[model samples]
Target: MTDTHEKRITQNASALDLAMRLRQMISAYQVSQAIHVAAALGVPDLLQDGAKPCDHLARVTGADEDGLYRLLRALAGVEIFTEVAPRTFALTPLAALLRSDVDGSLHALAVLNGQDWFWRPWGRLADGVRTGSSVFEPIFGVHFFEYLQQNPAARGVFQKALAGASSRAAVADMYDFSASRRVADIGGGHGALIAAILGKYPQVHGILLERAAVLEGARRYLESAGVLDRCDLVESDFFESISAEADTYILSQVLHDWNDEAAHRILSNCRKAMASDGKILVVERVLPESGVQKGPLMDLNILVLMGGRERTQKEYEVLLARAGFRTTRVLEMGEAWSLIEGVPAE
Candidate 1:
């Protein structure tokens, strides 16, 4: 072949590669939603004890047998489930965790993110990217939180998902509550972290702040987690007000759900309520410096859904500085999580 022709062919091939990647990236959402559907149908749970053939599993799940077979095979291809024999699938370690009855389950998140309301907002992702507004209002005729407040079942799923996302017990794995006398868990839903801290630190007391409707689960979960002895639930927006008289304040995976202005408002509230020498611990997946941090995906997810984005360490430092706090140190935890400590700036 002529040199000019070879160069043209290589350019055309690269163009094809880029186009194919774009197509696959877009269509990947279907694979995710399919997994959600399977999780909802309890497919992994059914295959827990042993493998099952397509027809039997199909009958149980009320899915088309032939179609179901293809789905199981696809999931197996991804190491989510394993097809030990033709038309028969068994649960893989990854898929087994999706079981609804599992102690730490992501089943609620799977369902919620794949449902109609959430799905619609995601469909408008490009719009959100361009406009810097929540697509939820335009698509659903109301704000995402407002919709969640009105729907009890959806609210349960959302709150449960948030609670379930973090498997660590705050007292057991996260904080040295023994050193803390009082904590303000700002935007602390389901009271998981507060409960853990209060339960572990005999001398520590806590105030859990969140929206009124969302506090139902926090109240109940805290009581169940057995930290009710030293903690009180406050029903209010964290941006509007925060609990006073706390030595430390916490914002966990919460800041990523808002724009800088909104986040500053919340942090400033925490600052106002924080004692003069008090500290604040904001827990989040601090975006990495080198590459595509998991924070970006979550940041993007929030961008599309909640009009928010996650921040890198520098970004967090800037935001905290603006909110009258100084970023002190960051401690890395499991799978893209970090506990960032900040102090009231002089």
Candidate 2:
């Protein structure tokens, strides 16, 4: 072939690669939607007893048989469900978690992200990145928390989503809280972490500091968890007030929600409230070095959602050191998150 012909062939190959990539990028939403729809329709639960004919399943779900068949095929394509034979679908391990009644259900997350609240803001992600602010406010015409307050249905769904995400991880019970007797969880919405610790250590008591409205939900969760008797729920703003007394304080995924100046204000409040020998537990994802793929996909969210970030170990250390705390240790959790221990300096 002539040199011109060879160049054309190479260029065509590259074009094909680009075309394939673009298609995949565009279809990514569809793939997750399929999974979300399958969960919403309770398709996996339908197959729990045994595999059934597609028509029978569709009738039970009040969906079109043909449409259900296509959804099952798409889910199977993504390894969420498997078609044992034509028109017969069986549950795969991945699909089992989609069952709403299951203890480990991801149904809440599926509902939240698949619905308009999260999806709409995500659509404006580019605008957020460009402006260095949340498009959530622009897209919804109010802040996220305030939106939840006004929209009760959205609020319930959001709480369920938060609980669903919280359920998958190691809780405060899994940590060593022996160093401190009294603990405070600042902005600890729902109080799940503090409740987990109180349950584990009878001697340890905790206070959950959060907004007034969220404290209602947190109280419900704490009471249901059977830890309300031991844990105190204090409604306050971290920008204005943090609990003024605690032997140890915990802030999980908190600081990243704001810029450096806001983070300093929050940490400075915690510092003011701490005992002279208090320790701060900063539970957050420690961003890995270049080329490391991480969990929860929240780092990208930091860009689009809240303008926060996942920090490196070095960044946390420096941030704490500047705030009059010594970064003592970082304990790796099973997930991308880590427990960063900071103590007030002498």
Candidate 3:
């Protein structure tokens, strides 16, 4: 009843709330791995029709019944799945997104991120921070892209995860391709962006320049999208040279996978291959200049995995200028990406 007593109670409650939140934050990796296991086991896909008993799911997924129950229960606590009845689980809205058949599925992402090859790099994140460089090559004895090149399964999962992360075709909605005669998508994984562009601009031919490891998948994807006929698949490395000449070049979610010098090389290659009055569209997540933001965590992830840092608008402008291009404008595409338009610098 006393003022001091009430104040003391309020302080204790606040401390308890903060402690609870911090605990959740600290244990987030448990949730992530659990979700990964569930996704990898096809639990979400199994439950797509309706709720099911844990035993049935276990039998289908070849998992132990009690172990599956425990996993589902823990995930239910995090709202990823819901326990509809005793030892029975159903997909939550979050769980639905993990189904491989769904639109915007995170199934591949969950599997890819939780795989030992990708997960172990985070354990060396402190070293990456200390050295101010990627820890992936040091840990795996190969660069990230090189590792993917050597591992076909990992490459497939990585490309699918990226394709599912965003609307692969959404970038076309933000830019005008009517005037573009030919568009070159450099290092375009699966040719999603160029396929989208070709789908929209029926007259624009596409040149997809990628490594031999990725060219086959890109061909399959572009073919399925019905744009393969208009797109040429060129087996080439962006770091060494670009053989395709086009008026417009697209580097979608590409540059952020490398350091500045490497990114500059890629851009300079585009500058050299593109037509005299060409334009480049750099599609990436533009980080904020300062303060707490959603991009820094990803920035740290990139640092740990690939030694690249997402840049602010000004940083991008300067990078573009160094590549012999003048940044004309930055247009907002989807919620998390921007289309930075540049022209050959005068």
Candidate 4:
């Protein structure tokens, strides 16, 4: 082949490859939805033991046989499942993560993603970007928290989603609870972090501050963690008052759900309720100055759903300073989150 002709052909092939990648990127949402559907239908749970035929899975899930087969085929292409036989599929390693009973399961997260409360707001992302306001209220006719308060089932799903995202074991080890006699987890839904900390430090007493509706679930989770007797589940609003004078206060993925002013107010409340020697552990995703990180996506999600934005370390420092606290240190947890330790300013 002539050099010029060969070069032209290679360029065309490269262009086609790039275009294919772009198309895949564009249709990524479809893949996410498909995984959600499989999880919602309990396909992964059903396939936990062994491979199953499409017809059987369809009958168990009350879905069309052909449709289920197509979904399984598509998911197999994505390595979420494997087609070991004709019209029969088994869970892949990735698919096993969707099983509800497994540790570190993404089942709740997948189910939440498929729910109306979570997905509908993404439809109004443009509105959120343009107005710098939450589209959730406009779309759902109520604040996100209010909606969760009214809908028990949705609230349960939301809590499970949070649990999946934040590892209690990781958060527990991120800080030193040895010095803390009383630990208060403010806005601690389900009390997972507190339970983890209290479990590790049996000498520490935990107090979980959450909404009245969520306290029941927190109680149940704490009890299951074997830390119920060491923890007190209190129903209160963090905005109004925390009403806890604990030496250590944990706000896990909490402040990121509000704008700067609101986040400052929350820190101010923590300062007000804190003991003189107390420290505030603000666990959140600290955004970088410039780069592609999951923090930006999480920031956009907060903006779309709750009118909140994730902050950088400097921003957290400023907020803590404004709230009469000093940023002592920031401990990188090696994940998307970090532990920002703040203490009462002298």
Candidate 3 structure lDDT: 0.90
Alpha-carbon TM-score of each model against the true structure:
0.87, 0.87, 0.97, 0.97
Model 2, which residues run further than 4 Å from truth? 1-22, 101-104, 166-168, 295-297
Assess candidate 1 and give its TM-score to the true structure.
Answer: 0.87
Cα misplacement distance, residue 302 of candidate 2 (Å): 2.3
User: Can you tell me which runs of candidate 3 are displaced by over 4 Å?
Assistant: none
Superposed on all Cα atoms, the candidates' RMSDs to the truth, in angstroms, are: 3.3, 3.4, 1.2, 1.3
lDDT of each: 0.81, 0.81, 0.90, 0.90
Compose the digit string of candidate 3's lDDT tens values, residues 140-225: 99999999999999999889888775745678887889999999988888887888889889999999999999999998999899
Using alpha carbons, what is the TM-score of model 4?
0.97
Better of 2 and 3 by lDDT: 3
Lowest summed lDDT across 10 adjacent residues in model 2 is found at 165-174
Which 10-residue window of candidate 3 scores lowest in summed lDDT?
Answer: 162-171
Clashing pairs in 1: 190-218
Model 2, 50-166: lDDT tens digits are 788999998999999999999999889878888998989988888888888887788778877787777777788778768877777877788777888788788778777766655
* Ranking 2 against 4 by TM-score, winner: 4
